[model samples]
Target: MKAILYLPLCMVLMSLNLAGQYAIDAAGSYVKNGAYSAAYSVGEVSTLTVRGVHSTYVSTSGVIQPDPLSITGTKNPGIATIRIYPNPVNDFLRLETDRTDLIQYVIYSMQGSFLAQGTVRGMSVQLDYLTPGMYLIKFSLVDFHESQSFLISKL
Candidate 1:
């Protein structure tokens, strides 16, 4: 009789021990299956599952709600090779790329207003007149486009 009760108690304890927390970096994603015991990563999408635990879903545009019993992480779906330097620039901004071919770059205000546009062959852009504020920097390949928002402050 006591042995049967002990078995049940042990199972409960084991379940509690399995519960853990996980975070997904991607914007729009979801997790399914027990305590997230299974995991898969393909390109920009990631899927995880744990036995007997709740599933989690994270999306690029969605809120991040992590499961306490299961741990998971995700990478961004769309990432570019372009890089920006002096992120918090005061006067001049530099955008660099590895590609030797012509690249199109655009700068926009946080409000989505176009601030500057030009072509570059050396993989770098120098912005010397833009004011200090939050702005969006967009780099475009032949068909793919990636944009990141950054802040600028005068030193």
Candidate 2:
């Protein structure tokens, strides 16, 4: 009985000694918490970059600045002359533009996945097939590089 109990106690002690903790220590820059670990460098350049459909943002140094991505009733240069109505639309969505040369359009989901594409017919496109969600429609000219993207919703 004593031998069996002694062996079991020794196994438990050994197991406790084997409990996990990070083994790698490099220049003493490692930090560890319960089940979490991280290593840090002393001198490293970090930057933040954000890209949008209409603009781009970058931060080289850590400084708080006004949000450059907010939409404040201003128009994007590419789509300044373009307009769409019935934003949260049902059945059909209408397009209004000064230029009648708009020839093609592509529909994309909010996650940037292409869902549909077709030539522009008349002044509207039938969106009755799309499930209710947010989408983006890109319109392009027939013989020009001018293209515009508009965000719309399906209801």
Candidate 3:
């Protein structure tokens, strides 16, 4: 008798949980569709307005969570498209690009000290002089106004 009653109670609780999952999924879809405001909290401690693409959260304790996308920022990834290989390079580092003309490169230490600067000679630039560590490479195309930064490793 008890086992039969227990089975129905368990089924009821499981069904409610499954329905809640569907409701949350639908709410997430609505959030992706348009800007909408929603808040949830345990008791009256904190109320967060996590709404749309630019949504954020805040608590009564004054803690806050900014929109994730804004935190990282954004960049064009322009010349970073070019292949730079033998990374952790021992000697020369190559900058392979279709338009090599008028290209200028400046290498800087991880600490922002100017290490090397020059035009692209062929496809590769010499890093034979640099001590093994990390460096930043800034590449610029004179007329094109195109620039990109690359974090490189040396060995």
Candidate 4:
């Protein structure tokens, strides 16, 4: 019964392009997800560094900054995988993947409505135009596919 209701919504969202336009309200804050969560301000270095290649994170203000907390020791990103942090996304979302292969990602509303979809470019996605709410992001890799939901908070 519930599947019937959500099926159409998912289908419709898939049909729509990955461009969602809505006014974003409130200031962005830090949201840590699990042990691998970090959010830096407009011009601050993040503590989470891996493989000497520190990955930059997107601020709720939609600003991108460096991710190097220190410069003494070097580290390598242990696992070659994809990671999306600050589940409660806003302003901008960072999409990180160790592989350079083509991966398609789609953002959908909790109700299964498609919100955004596109290829990961520079490991980030702009969300300043989306309304605050819960959303699901589905990533399509070459060998497998996965979906994860996130809360888009106005604050």
Off by over 4 Å in 1: 1-80, 143-155
Work out how many backbone clashes candidate 2 has.
Answer: 0
For residues 19-69, what per-residue lDDT tens digits would candidate 4 score against the true structure?
763223343455454333454444233333334456665433334333434
Residues 40-144, candidate 2: write the lDDT tens digits.
434225556899999999755322223224334754454336688889999898888877675688999999999999987888889999999999999888777
Cα lDDT of candidate 1 equals: 0.60
Alpha-carbon lDDT, every model: 0.60, 0.75, 0.69, 0.61
TM-score of 4: 0.41
The sequence of per-residue lDDT tens digits that candidate 3 reaches over residues 83-104 is: 6887889898887776645778
So what's the TM-score on candidate 2? Answer: 0.47
Q: Which has the higher lDDT value, candidate number 2 or candidate number 3?
A: 2
TM-scores across all candidates? 0.39, 0.47, 0.47, 0.41
Q: Which stretches of candidate 3 lie over 4 Å from their true place?
A: 1-80
Per-residue C-alpha lDDT of model 1 across residues 54-145, encoded as one tens digit per residue? 75555432234555563466666445556667867765566665554456767778788888887654555666677556777766765455
- Backbone clashes (count) for model 4: 4
The TM-score leader among the candidates is 2
